[model samples]
Target: MTDEPALDSARKPVPAGTPDADSAAAPWWTRAVVYQVYPRSFADSDGDGVGDLGGIRAKLGYLAELGVDAVWLSPVYPSPQHDNGYDIRDYQDIDPVFGSLAEFDALLAEAHERGIKIVMDLVVNHTSDEHDWFQESRSSRTNPRRDWYWWRPAAADGGPPNGWRSAFSGPAWTLDGATGEYYLHLFARQQPDLNWENAEVRRAVYAMMNWWLDRGVDGFRMDVINFIAKRVELVDGPRPSVDGGSPMGPQIHDYLQEMHREVFAGRGGEHLTVGEMPGVSVSDAVLFTDPARAEVDMIFQFEHVSLDQGEHKFHALPLSLPALKKSLSRWQDGLADTGWNSLYLNNHDQPRLVSRFGNDSEYRYESATLWALVLHLHRGTPYIYQGEEIGMTNVRFDSIDDYRDIESLNHFREAVQEFDRSPAAVLAGVHTMGRDNARTPMQWDASDNAGFTSGTPWIAANPNFPGINTVADRAGERSIFRFYQRLIALRHESPVVALGAFSMLEPEHEQLYAFTRTLGDETLLVVANASDAPLVGPLPVDVTGGDLVLGNYAGADGSGLRPWEARLYRL
Candidate 1:
C-alpha cells in the first residue's frame, strides 16, 4: 500500500476558518451530534434480559436532556440473533426480541416529538442464511434468484473459490452440499454477502431504503457499506484475513450515486446518510463524501482507530500519540475543502474510549471528559456511543464463557486450539480488546444489573457501574455526563466549534493534545494533558488574554495543566 502524503501535500483548500456560504442552508445534521444506541445493551423494558424498542422510547427524555440531535439505533430487524441483529432476516419488520414494528414506530414518533432525529442502522450488504431471499437462491444452481448472492463453483481441487477469511475468524466461503457451490460471507457463515453486481439486488436494496424513509426514519448508518462492491474476478490470495476480499471496488461510487438518486433524491436535505467504511483512504473518502457527488453526507474512516491495532483487532500495539495526531490531521487536511467528517472514538464495535485511550482507573472522569472535549472540537459531526457519556468502561469477565460476541469467541478458539497460544493469554487479549468489552449492558442506575433489566441481563453489566452509572454521574457536581452535555451544547451554539478549520498545535507532543479551531474572527484554543502525571512544559499556545470558556478543573489556568486537565479558551 502507498503512503498517504503529509499534511502539506497539494490539495484543494477551503479558505481557512471560514464557514461555507451554503452551510447556512445545509442540512441540520452538518453540526449535529449523533448518539448511537446498541439496542441489546441500551435498556430492557421487558425485563427479559434484552433491550427493546420500548426501552429506547422510555429513555428519549434522558437523551433529549443530553442534547443530541439524533439517535442512531443499531439493527433491530428480525433475525436469528447472529451478529447481534446485523444478519437481518427481514428488512421491513422489527425482531420479536426488540419488539414489533408498532413499537419501533412508537419509538420513532417519540424521538421526533422530542426534536431528535432517528437514524436506522442499514445492514444490506449481507443477510442471514435464514433469510428467504438467501434460502431461495441457495436452493438450486439454476434458481432464478441464484444471482442475488455471490455463488462460485469449486476450484479444480474441489476446494473453495478463494482464500478469503471471514472477519469472525473462519473461511469466508461456506460450501453448500446441496447446491455443490460456495457462497461468500465476509463476516460469519450465517451472513452471506449480497451480489451488488446484480441490478435486481441493487433495486431491491434501494426499494427497502425508500420504504424505511417513507416510514419517517430520518436517515441511515450503513454497515460496512464499502464492502458491497467486490472485484469482478475473485482471485486466490495468500491467506484469509479480517477483510476477506477487495474493498472499495470500482463500482462503489456508482452504486452509491444510484442509491442516492433512487432513494433520497428530491427528499429534501433532511436525511443524513453516513457510510461506515472500514478501509477507505483519504482520497477515496473525499470522492465519497463530496457534497456535489451526492454519495453520502459523510463517511466513517478508520485510520485513527487502527493506529493501536496490529495484525487484527485482538493483537494490540502501543499507541503513538504522534501517529494518532498525524492520522487525524491528514483527514482534516484532506477533507477541508470537499468532504465532511464523522468524528468518534467509541462505537458498538470498539472497546470503551476511556479504557482504550485514557486512564479508566484513578483518572476516569478527568480523562473521559478530556477525550470528549478533543473529539467534539474537531470539524465534523460527532457521534456518541451508548453509555460513553457517563464514563462507562470495558467489562472484565473472569471466563470466556461470559462473552457473547461471535468475533471474540471465534478468536479464542483459533488462538488456543489452532495457534497453540495459552488460553489465559488469549483471554487476557479478549479482556483488553474484545468487541464484548463494548457490548456490556448499559449502566443506568446502581441497582441490580445496573438497572438495565430486572432479570439477569443477556450480558453482565460492568462491575464498576455503581459509581459510573448515569444516575450517579448526573448527580455529581463534576461528572463526565455533565461535561458531555456542555460539549454538545457548545457544538449547537458555536459555529466555530462545528464548522471551523482545524490546526494542530503540537504535532509531536507526547503528553499534550493541543489544537485550535478558527472561524472568521473567532478562534478557540483547546489544550489537554492526556496523561496521568502533571504537564510542566511550555504551553503550546499563549492563552494569557483569552477568556476561559470551558475546563474540567475548577481552578485551571494558564500557569500549568494538571493531570488529565482539558480546557477551552476563547481568544
Candidate 2:
C-alpha cells in the first residue's frame, strides 16, 4: 500500500460554491453533458454476443456527433459477472469479455481525439469474492490480510451476525466454510464488503485511483461510495430494510476528503468526479460536493428516483407528477447556492425514463423530448443513458429466464418461493422496475439483434426495436435524437442554463411541470404539460410573451400546451 498523508483538520473550510482566484475560468463539466454506456449492451465487435471496448471505439463518431462531452463506461474492469461487472476481481485490468487493457487505451485515445472524455465507473465499496485481496483475506482467520474484509464470528444462535437483508434479497452476511466466520456482503454473496476501517485498505484504494488518473482517464463515477464507511459495531437493524445499523457511518466525509487529497489534489481542473450516494440528504450532499472540501464535483442522489417505489424498488406504484416536481424542486433549491447535482432519470440500475416517467405509448416522441427538455434546462450537469436519446421503452419478458440481471432474478425467487408471492404479480412488477429493462442491447437499427451484435445477444433485444431504433429516430422528421442534440447544444451555448438559480413554478399543478432559470440579467422559463391530455389553463403573461427558444411541437404559440408538449422561453 502507498503511504498517504492524513487530512488537515486545522484548515478552515471555504464557503460552498465559492470560487478561488485560480478558478476564474469555469470547469469543463459545468456546461458539459455526459453519456453513460453499459458496455456489455452497448455494441459487440467480436461477434461473441457481448459488447467490448473495440465496439465502443467503433461508435466514437456517433457519440461525438451526439455532442456529449464525456462517456461514462459502467464497470469494464475484470469481474465474475455476478453483479454485471460490479463485482470487480481486478481493479486495473479490463475484463476478457470486454477486451484487453490495450483496447481500452485505444478507445480512450480515440475518444480524446474526438473531443470526448472517458469516465470509468469506480466500484471500490466491495470486491468479488474471487478477487486476490479477498481470497487472501478469507484464506484463514489469522492470515495477514484477514482484516481487509469484514469477517465476524457466528452469533450465539449460530445465524448471521445480524438480521440485515441483502439488496438482492437474502442475508447480508454469508458464512465462510473455510474460516468458520461470516463475511459481510451488502449486495451479492460473491461481493464481500471491504473494511474501510483498515488504513491499508484505504491506502490501497487511493493508490489504485492514482494509477487510473495517471493513465489519462478523465474521471470516475463512484458506485455506492457512501457505503464505504460502515458502523464500527455491526449491530442489528430494522428487519427487511437492509439498514444493518445505518451504512452511512460517521466517517464517510472524512474518508472522502482523505481520498480527494491523496488521489485528486493536484490532478488539474479538467477531471470530473461524481459519487453515487443512496439515502444522502440535501445537507450532507452540500458538504460532500462543496469545492472547498475537495470531496467530489457532484453526486447522484436517489431521492427523486425513489418517488414511485413502494417498500422496495420492485414494488412499483403510479408516479405522481406533483410529487416528482416537489422532490426535484427541493434538490434544485437545496443545492442552488451550494453543491452541484447530477441530473439523470435513467441508469444501469433503473428502468427506462420514458417507460417510467413519461408516456411510452402514443406520445413517446413528445414525452421523451419533453422529459429531456425539462431535465437539461435545470441548473446542473445532465446525463444521458444509452438508447435514452432514441426513447427506448421497457421490455416485458414472457418468462424470468429471459432476464439477465441478478437483482431481478434473485427478487423473483425470493418473492415467489420464499415470500409466497403470485408469479403473475411478481412478473408484472419486474416488467416495470427491473434493472434488465435498461440492460437490453442498444437498439442501433431495425436489423436482427437490433444491430447490437452479429451473433446472438447475451440478453434479448426489445421486440419494439423495429420502430424505436436509433436509425429510424435519426432519420425521422420529429427526431428525439435531434431534440437531445439541440438540448446539449443549448447547454453549451448558454451560461444561464448551467449556473442559473432554479425556481419551480406551479408546483401544485398536477399536469404542468414548470420552472425558471435565472442568471444575472437573463432568465429562462421552461413549461411542459406532463399529462396525456392537452393543458388548457391561464399561464403567466410574461411566459406567453417571451421569445420561444425551443419547443417539442411546432407553432406552440403559448395559447396552451398540447399533449406532452414542452417549450423553453427566454424572458
Candidate 3:
C-alpha cells in the first residue's frame, strides 16, 4: 500500500442530512454525553493530595446536574505512574493511591443509582515494569510468564533487535539483565508492551474486563487499546519523520479483532467500548469498529487535536478557526457511516479547549460558549472533560522540573538537545499542549486548592480561579457552567440535536458555521459565529417560522448572531 499523507488523500464526500447509513440500527449513543473524569485531577477526598474513586463518588451529583449520561474515568488502576496511569500494573485492581476495590464498587453503585454509567479506562497495550507478571517475565527465560511481554534477542551488531522508538523518545527496547534480553515498550521504558500473541495474556485481560462488567460498571473507556496488537512480522518502520520516528507500527488490527471475539462479544449488546487510537485514519479505524466484527463501540480520533500543533510537528502554533473547522469536518464526515466517533476536545492528554480554542482575553466566556456550541452541536457522542464546563484553562508550569507528565518532560528535553529550542519555548509548548492542562486540580471554587483538596494538591491549579470555577459559575445564571448545563440538557431533551440526521449548511464562509439536524418533521438549526468579530452571512435555506432556543450573544434574536455568539433554533 502507498503511504499517503492523511490529510491530502481524497475520500468519498458524505452528503449533508444523509442519515448515518445505518442510523435505524439501535443508536445506543444517541442522547449520551460522556463526562470525562481524569480521576487524578477530579477531586481528592482523602487529603492524600491525589484524586480517587472516593472523590469521584462525592461529586456524582455534580456530574448528574451537568446532565451527562456517563463518566469516562481516565485510569484508576494500579500503576507505577510511569505515564501517569497509562502504564498499568494490574488489570483488575485499583491503585492504593486512588482507593481499594470496595471503593470502586461503591462508586459504580452510586453512579448507576444517579442514572450515570461508569466506564473504566482500559490500558491494554502495556504493563508496568513493577507488575508481578512483567517481573516474572523478566526474571529468566524459563519463567512461566516469560512470553507475557515482548522480548527479543540482541542483534548481531550487539544492539537492540529493531530501530523502533518510544512515543516518549529514545529506543523502544529496554535491557533486562535477568534474561540478558531486551523488552519492547512503545512508550516509556517502565511500560513494557504486552505480548498479545500469548493466549494466556489475552485470557487474563478478558477475565478482568468481565469482572468489571459483572460488578455493574457500565463499560470501558479504553486507553491506547489499539496498541494491544502490533505488526506480527516485526519489520522496521519508516525513517523517523523528525529526529525520532512515527510511533505507529504495523499489523495491530489482528490482535484487536481476536480480542473482540474472545472478550468484547460476551459483554452484552448494550455495553460501550471506546478506544484511544491516536494517529489512526478513517479507513484504518473502520477495521477496528466494523459492525460485523465489533472490536469496539467507538474510537477517539486525534485530527481535531492536531489543529493546535505547529505544522513543523514539534512546535506550538496559534489556533486558526478555519483549520479547526476543516479538521472537525473531516471526522464528522469520515466516520458518519462506518463507525461511531468519541467526540472530544479537552481530555487527559490535551490542553483545555476553552484555553486553546477560545480567546484567553476578556472574551473568555463568550469564546468558551462558542467552543461548546461548535463541539457539542455536531454528530457523534461528545466527551466533556472535567472542569471544562467552567472554562478551565491550561496550567502554567514555571520549569520542566515542575511538570509531572513523562511525555511533556521527554519532549522538552528533546526540543532542547536536538532542535536547539529555547527552554522558554519548550515550556510554552508544554503549557499549550501538555498533559498538565488536564491534570490541573479541578477548580471547584476560589477556596484553597480550588476546593479540590482539603490540603495542598499534587499539582498546582490554573491561575484563573477567581473568574472561572464551578461555584462562581453555578452562582451566576449567565455563566459557562450554566451554558454547558443548557447545552447538555438541550441535546438530551431534543431529538433534533441528538438522534436527528446532521447536515452542514455553509462550508465556505469563514466566520459563520451552520448545520441542521432533522428528526422526521422536527428540525433544529445550529448556527455559530466562531470568530471574535461579528459576522453576517446568507442563510440560503428557508426557515419561514421557528423559535429561538439558545444563543451566546446578548442581542441575538431569531435572525442574526453577534461576535463569538451561537444560537439554536427549532423550525
The C-alpha RMSD of each candidate to the native structure, in angstroms, is 4.8, 3.1, 5.5
Report, for every candidate in turn, its global Cα lDDT versus the true structure. 0.87, 0.88, 0.76
Error of 2 at 294 (Å): 0.9
Q: For model 3, what is the C-alpha lDDT against the true structure? A: 0.76
Superposed model 3: Cα runs more than 4 Å off: 1-24, 235-254, 311-314, 417-419, 537-544, 557-560
Model 1 regions lying over 4 Å from their true place: 1-16, 19-23, 235-245
Q: By summed lDDT, which 10 consecutive residues of candidate 2 come out lowest?
A: 7-16
lDDT of 1 by residue, 425-497 (tens): 8998899899898889999999999999998999989899888899999999888888999999998888888
Write candidate 3's Cα lDDT for 1-571 as tens digits.
1122111111122233444533445355656899988888889988988898889999999998988999888888888787888888887889999999999989988888898988888887888888899889988899999999988887666777777778798888888887789888989999998888788998898788778878888788777776676664452443223334334456466565565665555444566778888778888776666555456667988877787677533467876666766777776667666665667888887877877777767677888887787778887788898888988888787888888888888888887998798889878878777888888899998988888888778887777786678999889867888888888887777656665666777677777778787766778887887777767554545555777787776655545567778777787
The local lDDT score (0 to 100) that residue 287 gets in candidate 2 is: 91
Clashing residue pairs for model 1: none
* Backbone clash tally (model 2): 0
Backbone N/Cα/C clashes per model: 0, 0, 2
**Candidate 2 local lDDT, 158-193, one digit each (tens):** 888777778898988999999899999989999999
